[model samples]
Target: MNHGAFRPIELRAPEGSVVDVRDDAPAGAHGEVRKRAVSVALGALSQIIPDLVSGDLCGTSFPNAIGE
Candidate 1:
């Protein structure tokens, strides 16, 4: 096996946040963990709720707002 050619990679979270895990977790588990972590973080932020629910925070300008 050519071990020299392999390198460890560091994963990064999106621009506005930090990642909690970088180990060899499965894709589905990673996604669920990330989703729950994001939900909790955003829930703590609180003010982002309306914009998240409204979908206009991203500047797409939701025509009907959520749950219309």
Candidate 2:
């Protein structure tokens, strides 16, 4: 998985509990914080998507547009 971009998603536990998960880290920071955020996002997605789809829409296409 890419160690960048923020992907927010909602997850529900087996007991019907819902939680909001997000990757709220600044782009271009390839440190521990950014890695953790990416891991969390990926973990949440793994638990949510039965059959994950791989595509360009999964990340920020214009990463360089904002002067990062």
Among residues 3 or more apart in sequence or in different chains, the pairs in candidate 1 whose N, CA or C atoms overlap within 3 Å are none
Report the C-alpha lDDT of model 1 over 1-68, residue by residue, as the tens digit: 48755345355576434354434533434444555555655565567545433112322222332442
Whole-model lDDT per candidate: 0.46, 0.46
The TM-score of candidate 1 is 0.32
lDDT of 1 at 29: 40
lDDT of 2: 0.46
lDDT of 2 by residue, 11-54 (tens): 45343212322346333434433445456666666777836723
TM per candidate comes to 0.32, 0.32
